[model samples]
Target: MLDAGIYEQLSRLVIAMKQKSSQNMAGNRRSVQKGTSAEFSDFREYMPGDDLRRLDWNVYARSERMYIREYFEEKEAVVSVILDTSASMHYGKKSKAELAQDLCAVIAFLTLHHMDRLVLYDSSQMGTPLVVSGGKNALPKVLGWLQARTFSGTETDSFSAVRQMQRRGAGVTVIVSDFLTEAATDPTQDCLEKTMQYLDFTKQRPVLLQTLCAEELRVTMDGTRNLIDMESKEKLRVTMRADVIARYEQELQKLSVRLKKSASAAGGTYILCDSEKERRALILEDLRPLFV
Candidate 1:
């Protein structure tokens, strides 16, 4: 369960972020269509049939340049929040699955509050898509959907999931997952290339990757224990020596670094979240900048 105070804080942070920058969606966000909004952007040379009122008289008088002021188009964006419900997400210190749900709920609430459409997708259920049109009544349904969901699925095939979402059309795609899927049969580069081809075909809108976990980032486990794959139920038992632990940590860091690089190469924003941190602050301080 999410704390009321945290929810309130998340609301405030989003509000504050919106206030700070009018250009919140300028470069990173794609518009659905052009519309009238009196936010002056740039001056362009007047074209035939241009509005007379938009002509810059001052520039016309000083430099004799027939320039017209252009304003940015204010278009509403559709935000789709995709949460990975795979078994691996259920094993984090603070439960990555729960955190993903909470984050998705908060984002959906904020997007609707700002008059943007919200869509929720669970990869486990490929056919049914949960959509909420931006309005006052949407929040209840969004929250309920998050609460009712149970994370008990097997492995997550992120590339396949991305392809599925793309077929539904373009929008801001926010994917939340640990991204530690089984190695593809093909080379990593080859797999990514194929995925990118599909993503291109569907024209996926701006993508943001959020990886959630606590223990995955830093290992503090000691002594002999059984380490099991949450999805596969495959277990490995071994004595944990200090040297072995150090080597494991190094490998984990390498994997994380590779994942981050892959996301960047795919023209997406990547954010790693420690599940135990204050969710609001983490969202505000680390993730909000990518959107803004």
Candidate 2:
């Protein structure tokens, strides 16, 4: 879904991790382990048998004590991009599914550009999700897989896809969805919190990307209309008015607040994506914080 120019722009960036990875695979990002690297980590008192090369000779000459310099070991991080393929994603004038796919592709490109592992998950996938690792050479497979994705799930639960994933190692997860689960419609439900807890239990730091269409954000319809639930296919007939539209907007605001709070509580961040915005701006500007 990305053009060559977009890929070129993304090549200079790499996905930044909030926590040091514990994976043993060699990579370009810093890890929890200490090893020989250009990036200095800290200094520790030199012990017998310690490599003399790492010893701070100047310190030894001044303070009469030896200390060894340490560097953070670089290791690859696994990034899981979960796309919600629920029918609601197909509702927007500009399909949220398409936006979600593009976002996932951008993340994949960044992860692979930095030589990190990437695992893509979608709700419509029957069993295991597609996993790919390599440099730019693997981008074709990622793009093809994303191209085949279709939003057809009938479940209203956005996290159902995530819940079904096999437990993965410690890493960062990017979940792209409209997040219009039962919790959004019913304030009493705790779907968002529960999903965050699950991700935490899986040893994952989640990045919730909530995509919405312009029509959903601002209602323009007036008087008698039939509302249909994209997922459940439930129908309701009601007279639309100014107060009704205002109430809907209020509920939407509350949903965004709840999602942001839950993501933060789970050691992650929440991003509200407006599908109508330029894709380049979203990836290059709004998502810049994700890259380093």
- The TM-score values for the models, in the order shown, are 0.72, 0.82
lDDT of 1 at 236: 99
Model 1 Cα lDDT, one tens digit per residue, 159-238: 67766662333445667777677542233445544554454344443344555566776667779989898888999997
For each candidate in the order shown, give its overall lDDT on alpha carbons: 0.63, 0.79
| Candidates in order: C-alpha RMSD to true structure | 10.9, 10.1
Q: Against the hidden true structure, what lDDT does model 1 obtain?
A: 0.63
Give the TM-score (vs. native) of candidate 2.
0.82
Give residue 245's lDDT in candidate 2 (0 to 100): 88
Model 1, runs deviating above 4 Å: 4-32, 35-75, 166-168, 184-189, 192-210
What lDDT is obtained when candidate 2 is compared to the true structure? 0.79
Worst 10 residues of 2 by lDDT: 42-51
